[model samples]
Target: MDNDISKLKIERQPLLATPRKSRHLGRWIGIGIAVLVVTGIGFSMANRPTSVQLTSVTQAYPSQAITVLNATGYVVAQRKASIASKATGRLEWLGVREGSTVKAGELIARLENADLKANVAQAAANIDVARARLQEARAELQDASRAHDRALDLKQQNFISNAELDQVKARLDRAKATVAGAQSGIGAAAAGTEAAKVAVANTEIRAPFDGVILTKNANVGDVVAPFSSSAEAKAAVVTMADLSTLEVEADVAESSIGKVKVGMPCEIQLDALPDVRLKGVVASQVPSVDRSKATVMFKIRFVEKSDRVLPEMSAKVAFLERELTSHERTPKMAVNPAALAGDGKEATLWQIVDGKLKRVPVQRGEKLGDLQTISGPVKIGDKVISKPTDHLKEGGAAVVAEK
Candidate 1:
């Protein structure tokens, strides 16, 4: 019976069970896979580009560092005039127009003077008539004198009576009086001619000084009157200005007026010619402040004059601490101080090249308004990282942040 029960019971199957070596191999494979995934994630995070902000190294003028004050104004001519005629007449001839250059005493216009010319001619004829009468009177006086001498001799020789000699003397005296009257008439006629000539000269209009005509206030056939209120009568012949006397008239705040002084050096920039920086000096300041604007007006004269500059152009003026030297006038390389990564003595900035960060060594210089002058391999327009942080390794890729 024991032998039959042993035959019905099931035996343990060792072949079907898993082996220890195989389980150990499977566990090690799972562990290896997990380690690989963790390593891959770490490597990807390290290789990813870091986002950064950048600023460009630019060329800046040295004058920006020393600028004390800035003001805006307009160009104006110091010597300007509205030319008008002193005498009233029709403008028969106009010899100049707008933009014409004229010299002092140059004839610019003429008035109708036919009647005046006739008066001069008549006065001249009167003088000639008076002189002819004087000549006749002198001839009579000479004849009377000869006759009187003959009479005196005859009376001395007892050939004539005393009453006859007296009559001859009276005739001679009468001729002398007639000659004096003729001479007086000639002098009066000469004076009349001079007065007529002066009247004729008044018809011509001439320039008062050297200047360029800015506008033609009167044209040919326009009547010019010195004090006329009628619409048809022109008061001015032209408006003119001396271009050489061009100056900048700037207004400064009354509180800041103390910083300005006569003869102080300044830089002028015209809105018309923005890129051109002109040299100037403070010429004068108005004695009183403007009550409405609460500002003081001052004049700035150009050190170097340009023909292109004109009156009434908008301009900006910078009052400098001192005149810039020849070298200082030129622009120099500059960068924002925040981009620098080291102390003043040993400075370094990250410059971007080929989409990667590069550490460039530079020497620090004077501090401009918001930038620091630097001498390095960087040129104008080169982009550099501002406020660099750790993990931004040299030769590492970087992406620029949107402005």
Candidate 2:
């Protein structure tokens, strides 16, 4: 009975082992099938035909007149200056400081002028003394004249000797010489007084023109000089600029200089004020050219006054080909360059009409940069291919993609 029971247990073990091996084999087969199905789907998707979608933009006829040459420059005052002293002296008073609007002949600064003032006073006293001497000499001349007349009368009457008359005449001549000398001395002294007054005036600096004081180089107690190289000599007491007489100094390329002329209309755009466009004109073309830069400098003057404008503000100048006619001044629609096929003589563009690429003929005008002016039956809002592919033909079906 024990042997039979053992045999049955061995049989049960074989049955359990067979079932477990079969279950493991089934799991591997299921995994292999899943991988094969996934690979097949991936291959199928990749092989499928894909519809090519081309990127495109529309084109329209351009209308506005465009300027040819554009150059950058800086706004500068034509009559700007750095005012300095003509004579060396310690600055005693500064009448004007930075940002001070001054008129022509306005007093700007003054130097220590006590010495000059004293010299003028001394010169005036000398002139008075010389005048007194002149008066004394004139009185002597009158006396001499009376004596000479008496001498002549004596000679005529034969009451006095000829030698005595001659002696009286010599004395009268001597007095005349003294009077002339005194008169000359008075004239010299008067000239000295006038010169001293000029020196005193030089100590007081005045504005050369109507302007705004942009800088003040000297303060009270600073030593100012006539732009010399002494350690203590300050060159300029004040630096001013005429804001009303502002101009733009532009360096135009030598090649473009011929297109520019005096009085040509220009549109100025300041870098500081990008939104503000100022009207101006070509004031003058500098006669000399900068050889190193291969450019010609031009002067442009603004037509309108602007308080925002300042000296040395960077600017861009657009020199128009011709003054924009009243009709051309308004903004107009424009088209892309690729829309025009061929060499711009006769051009064609593809437009989608009824889900088809319809070829349209256009007459082309002058090219404005990368854009070209076109006249066609199409209107401004009409859609046209920017750059049509060679596969695109007349009456071909087009799948319009979202732009």
Candidate 3:
């Protein structure tokens, strides 16, 4: 039995010799391996993407390159007037409205003139009555002349006394005076008739010049006074302007007014029609400066007439150094100057393609305002890095910085 027990003790393998490895050592090593894996993941995340500011390629007008001065203005008519009647009366009939075209001496409206017409007719009738009276007096004068002739015959024959012959002569003289008075009355009546006709004509409103009606100030049944300050009575029947004399009135800063001059070429862009650019020339500069705005008025005339251009439209004018050529009038793709990575002929651009960096070669051209024109494989709307740094590399992941 003792020998069997000794063999069992020996089978314990010498108490398993004090273990060289601690039980917690393996746990600590596992923790260290996990920490290394997490650190590697964080390092990879930090290096994956670089934040950058980007700008898009855009189409720019060639005129921007040559623009010497820019100003805001409004379309105005050079020949504008408020059409009113000479006489005060109610507006009985209106033949025009806004946008109606009128010619010189054309009737545009009429006033209530029934009383004037009657006055004209009465004056004409008075003239006729005076003419009839003059005819009656002439007949009487003829009778008196015959009597006087007979009286003279009698006096020569001594058939009547001298006193009787004198009385007959007096009667003939009276008849002559009556005839002269009647003739004078006819002349006065004719003059009155002409005066009445003039009064009647004044009731008819006629256009003094060719123009287009811009506003209807007085409608039918409204009182129109020639010279009135009453609010109830309109001083003008309508407002009109000569569309052929349309012009742009721009306000140039007094400081920059020296840059502008008469006959300087200009390009006009109307806010109503943004795409259409109208050719123009500076017609005049107001000699006086506006005190409130500190600006000088510049009048510009259109070289080409456009039916689309209307009065009172907002406009932008670019006073060019020179007229744009046909090719330069077209729009070209452009970019900011900072987007180019290098100087001189070796300039390059960092383009962002699908969140990755791509190096593109570019040939710089003209300078438009603060932007630089370029010709390259890039198209409009392509996003490119602006102000690239040494850390930016081709084929690297990129992240757009929030503006």
RMSD of each: 9.6, 9.3, 6.4
lDDT of 1: 0.89
Task: Please tell me which predicted candidate would have the highest TM-score against the true structure.
Answer: 3
> Candidate 2 residues 1-403, lDDT tens each?
3566655554434454467888899999999999999999998865543222332333421122467688999999988888887888999999887889999999999999998999999999998888898889889889988998998998899999989988888888888898888889889998999999999888889999999999888789988889656888799888899998999999999988888899998878899986567778999989998999999999999986699999989999988866655554433344687665666467777787777668888877666566676777766667777666676667766765556
TM-score of each: 0.65, 0.69, 0.76
Candidate 3 TM-score, C-alpha based:
0.76
Who is ahead in lDDT, 2 or 3? 3
Clashing pairs in 2: none
Candidate 3, position 300, lDDT: 93
* Clash totals, every prediction: 0, 0, 0
Error of 1 at 160 (Å): 7.1
Clashing pairs in 3: none
Instruction: List lDDT for all candidates, in order.
Output: 0.89, 0.80, 0.90
Which digits, one per residue and each the tens of the lDDT, describe model 1 over residues 1-403? 3567768878887678788899999999999999999999999999988889988898777888788899999999999888777778898999988889999888888888899899999999999999999999999999999999999999999999999999999999999999999999999999999989887778787887898888998888999887666678998888888999999999999999989999999989899986678899999999998999999999999997888898899999999999978887777799989888878667988966788889999999888788889998888888889888867789998888888
- Candidate 1 residue spans exceeding 4 A from truth: 1-60, 147-181, 331-367, 370-403
